[model samples]
Target: MKRRIAVLLAGCMVMTALAGCGSTGGEQKETETGSIENKEVTEKSQDTGESSGAEDTISGEITMWTGTWNDGLMDTLLEGFYEKYPDVKVKFEYLPWDGMEDKYLSALQAGAGPDVLDMAIAWTIPYASMGKLQKLDEYIEKNQIDVSDYYEGAVETLYKDGSYYALPYRSETMCLFYNKDLFEAAGLDPESPPATWEELREDAVKLTSEDVYGFGLCGSNAGNTTAQFYSMMFSKGVSLLNEDMTASAFNTQDGVDAFTFWSNLYLKDNVVPKSVLENDNTTNRNLFAEGKLAMFVSGSYDIDPIMEANPDMNMGFALCPGFEGKTSAAQLGGWNLGMSDTCKNPDAAFALMSYLASPEVSVDFSSTFSSCKSAVDNEKYADEKLKVFIEAINYGVPLPGSPYMNQITDILYNEAQAVLSGSKDAETALADAEASVNKALQN
Candidate 1:
């Protein structure tokens, strides 16, 4: 499956990119800094002057752009939008994900973008900081929509500065998956997986043989490396950045310990495949399925591919192991919806957004874990294995909302790779990474 907004033009409405980012007739004002200031009235909401401030007044059309992965669900998801505001027209197109972020970046600079954009969780904060996204705090408060209803990790990614830019949409978490047969063969309990980092290492050592490594890790400079590393650091109580996010948090002794542990898994232990430097998530997944690896971490979506690759292989999964005495923490991944600052109909756009985020609709759009808590009641989610991931959501957290996320990912992975390759030790690597990341964040 396929995994993975701009400024507004003046009174002249322009539909250029993503088949036109949702923007229509509305008087526009651009300040000296180029931030759009199209004041939207509160009275134009769907709330009937009660819980939500409303009226049939919420009219006008909004254009939304998202990836084609949700192609068929578009109609089902928009059902709430159509019913809530009969007068408002909803227009959307699913674009390819490969260069979609670059397309949005270009569109924003040219002052032509969508009104409602379905953006990656990582992009929400950057866009909000750029004033490209219309802040939803006012709309959320007025409509009495509760943000607490969503997953905490997904919700964490939408905030920048003091305001949150988007509503949590789809959320997924990675968990530890193991081959039950392999576990039994290694004299380990097939039913009980690793509960802490020490246990994981012990199990990996016992499970490792000339042919099969116990655990798999990724080091390729892709997004998965950052995901895996951050998950490890978080589980061990290490944060990527300090509380204010001003400097590098990984330069500290705690970060050194975590990094050492991660690097040792490959260099010191040699339990992971030698292809780690070139490996990515897909590589590990395939290795695990091929019985070359006994354990790995990934999202629920990998279940199908593994079963398809080796139907007879017995599989078992559990929460990612925590550092000793700590709760399991996962690196949260998801998408969210945000309104463009240039959208003419704030009330209409916000109404549609709130509707889509409601508990009922969230389950429909979410591919893995719905941000809504009540979604567990859905019979499709009754599988016992999924419960492990759902529990993981409790401690999961998102990556920093830095504008330099791409650079940050590269530095994070490259430094770790340096340690793994013996080019640098853990202390030197983390210190160098700390300096580089701080410089990148400043820009």
Candidate 2:
């Protein structure tokens, strides 16, 4: 069933054009200053006697690249954009998440990238530094777009050096997803999910069985595992980077303690499985859905798959558990849309971007997929589940926006895997990871 849904989504995505900009049929204009011009042109009149004005005369095609998740959501969003601008055609190319980084880098280097691109928040800094992304401060100001409506963390993720490069379309934050069947089997309350880390530890120990683990972690999924680990650090009042983003502060005692907590779950308590060291986000998610695990940290995207896996599975989701000195913290994950530097129709592209950011269009887009805060706040989309997601965003933190965050995260995963596999202790693994990350930051 999961394979069928993936195939259907893939089929819908294949209908659109995903290639980059083709060669212009006329004399191509290249500007070193990166300034765009607005021009009006008209050929001999046809049947209609009316003349089109400059503002009504958008005539170029814009290509957009995105990762495939929900085809219904993309179609709905493009349908409205196409209706509003008949002259400007949009071509969408869907790329698999696994190879997206390499594909984006190659496209940019070849100067054949799409006009509009959807990328993870973590990639913004690296891409922006390479001049692959167009600065959007002027565009936002010219459009008079209100930034206050977006979740604070979502807005902060796209900024570098005090400039905005992209705008978020959807946001996801981690929550505790529990199986009611498991709770009943373990003589626990199904309705009340754990609200704090202490309660969660107790619940996990009680829920463990020979065939089923109490909890699961995504140690093999580097991006998500690092993100999940960071959320734990935040709950313990530790930050990945200093406020200036120049040095690594993750080696602090609080950071080490957070790592120890997850490691101890498998090492000392014997609640979660040692096999989790080899599992990624998808693997863990599948394990939970199959009723092999009691609880897991997951996002809104897991809803469809979990429901399909067990049609009668009674599952409950709550905000990430809090610690003694801190509130619950979930790391925000999402995609943003940005115009390419080589785009020919900047005006039309800006118009489309601005329209999409409006509350009405945002709500329409969110209805198909999980949307950002502005869309969730819309009365049309307001519901119990969405309200929970929105509240989760209020306590969410953005992933590290440093240009070298990818490298930093790689070190984190390597050490985390060692800790989980019992190849190294938490203190030694975290200390080594922190030093490696700090060295990478210097370069």
Candidate 3:
């Protein structure tokens, strides 16, 4: 997949006049790293009419599994899908986050899971390794789907080992969410969010008050902590793993500096609350919503929740800040739809996948939820914060799509908590983590 993307990147650079998909309202941008691979298709020109007669006729009962999407929104979107594939029936099996992996594994083992799996991008490699997903490269090429219109971060996450296992339906990247009211109270410009990490610290110190902390940190969960730290590390051009995915690359000077910067905020600067060590994403977001936190980092999805939690809160959003000379990087995440290995109707499954990924349908879907550039061309449905989130994708990078990512995150999380809890310094903790992860990679 990497080699193929390298080729595509070269092609894209030389092929300056390549056809673009979806609405051409905004300028399309490349990812932080110039790699282009197709997974979730971007915009399909409306000229490609629906399949007809015998060849286009795909009929079968295809089951789909997803997390927390509103039934009404899905039904409305699928209405168009059903119109195209009149013979294909879809049964959606909605599941909660709790025990979902176990449920999916058991069902797939018994050959009874849904034909389509709408799952987290992190799960793609693990499930693909388990031989639970169908390879989509052939399908993508045969259909001539152009994924270049999709956010580079979103599409890149589904590519692995020279194949793509899923199509990214939606995408999100982290942004700095701040309380404008708190900034005004602290005599800082409400419109001017921090442009650099040092500025962020200076403003945070000034914004910190007896009742409210300047920053809300969620350092409890291993995954959550690693994700937050990764945004900082990537901004400094520090990768968690080496090129060959053979060992940890995050114990170096840049890695240590990144970790130290975040840790010092909680320890030396005391700009974050002690409970930060116990908090998760939800906790920090809620704290910000309640106006107790002057600034926090979270995804675009948190916009509605924050607004709902505090209707009148003067909230502001901006891209994640980096060092003065460094480029910003936001951690990207979202759901993708994968075909089951045991799917009986491969053609029908592909049809459904393409339908969901189609520009028109994707636009409607993204309208009700956070989505990628390929899905929505304009900010018709987005507010100021959403616009910031969308623009940040140009600097977004997905977490290392290593099969051992879960294990590595576990190690980093534990080491990070140790640093925050004063049990270990950043150097020692990261070094220990590096040794452990390298050992795991060797195994």
Candidate 4:
């Protein structure tokens, strides 16, 4: 199966490369002047039923800035795109994820940003609000692409005030991953994964040992701990805002209850280890793989490494458990592709975007990269472990994508962490977060 997929991807890469060669012939004509005169030609072609091939005749170079994939896969995908449209030369600049936001914002301010950009779906709203991204509604409509095929949660993250500014290349959601071997040793049912908060707490207590932790909840200063906690809040029907992105709603009873639940796991239940207070996502993952953790919240991408590292360990996954009567909730985090407002060849850029967003190409990307959804429905790509992740998306929500989201998220995490460590009570912690978030929103 892997070999067949690889062969098909290689063929697609070659075809894409050939398209790039064809586009190179017209690069001179397209670059002779600034401001994309080809837009007018493309508009005329639209009326005449001419295809993207006709638009390819007018070409100019465009740069693409990306931060997601490692060098190997990044080079392959970019090379494939370059092969498809040689006329529209792409200057690919890979950015490190750590300082990407500042770098992108600085470039935008300096008026020297890339013509094609990759960003997390959560960053879409802030960038679009700053007028740094091009609105792609017309381009999408012109191409007659159906947006419904993409995961609904992923697609919604790219919209602001009814305008589409980005298209997701990959989507991800969290799930509860457990060690089957640990479950059996603990005298618990290995196949019966926890389905509720109570069940999870009970299982954790039963699984705890001197050498192994019952659960690995990353409570360190890492950003994802806050994200994971926020998803739990959502499962209890709490939200940061009241759907309008205008006010603080996270201080409600549901929010306090959720925080208290996590706090008790550390202080009273004693199921979670003290080491979790200093661990990040990688640390937590490594602990689980090393057999020090019985269970942890993990994404689909963690499967290969964990399996490879511990060949004899029986790993399993379940949907993130729910609160009371609520359904399980997972948080969406992934990258989206968009044409820069400065793109010299919008027509060609749109064409490339359409091809990349097609179901066929998306399926191949998901298979190769272990991503959740590209253009294909996630179900098509699911194995047993992946199915748990797919199931979680049904109730998954995108992170709050407001311009003030970053600041608010920081406040939320700090206050919640204080409560978890017993430095503050739940009521005081939530009140502080509410005040902080409200002030940030006002500013």
Using lDDT, give the best candidate's number: 1
Q: For each candidate in the order shown, give its overall lDDT on alpha carbons.
A: 0.72, 0.68, 0.71, 0.67
Candidate 4 on 1-443: residue-level lDDT in tens? 00000011100100000000111111122111122123434445557664555545746766667643332344444444444454555455766555666677677756777877766666666667667779999988977777876677777767777788887656667788999999999999999989888798999999999998888776775366676677788799787775666678988888889888877887888988797668776677788999988988867767877888887878889988888688898676666778766777787677666655566655544422222244224455556666666666656677666666667767877886787777999889989888887786665
Give the backbone clash total of model 3: 1
Q: Give the TM-score of candidate 2.
A: 0.82
Residue 30 local lDDT, model 3: 26
How does each model score on TM-score?
0.86, 0.82, 0.84, 0.82
Q: What ranking emerges by TM-score with the best candidate at the front?
A: 1, 3, 4, 2
lDDT of 2 by residue, 1-443 (tens): 00000001100111011001011112333211121111111222223444445435665777677654433356556555544454566666766555666777678767788888776666665566667788899989977788777777777766766788887665657778899889988999998888987788899988988888888877776666676777888898887877666678888888998889877877888877667767777777888889888888866657777889888888888888887667999776655678777777777777767666566776555423233554655676455654565678778776555666666777888898898887999899988987887786665
Kindly report which residue stretches of model 3 are placed more than 4 angstroms away from their true locations once superposed.
1-56, 68-72, 109-112, 366-372, 378-380
Worst 10 residues of 2 by lDDT: 1-10
What global local distance difference test value does model 2 have?
Answer: 0.68
Query: Which prediction has more favorable TM-score, 1 or 3?
Result: 1
- Spell out the clash pairs found in candidate 1: 6-108, 21-113, 21-114, 21-115, 22-114, 22-115, 47-52, 47-54
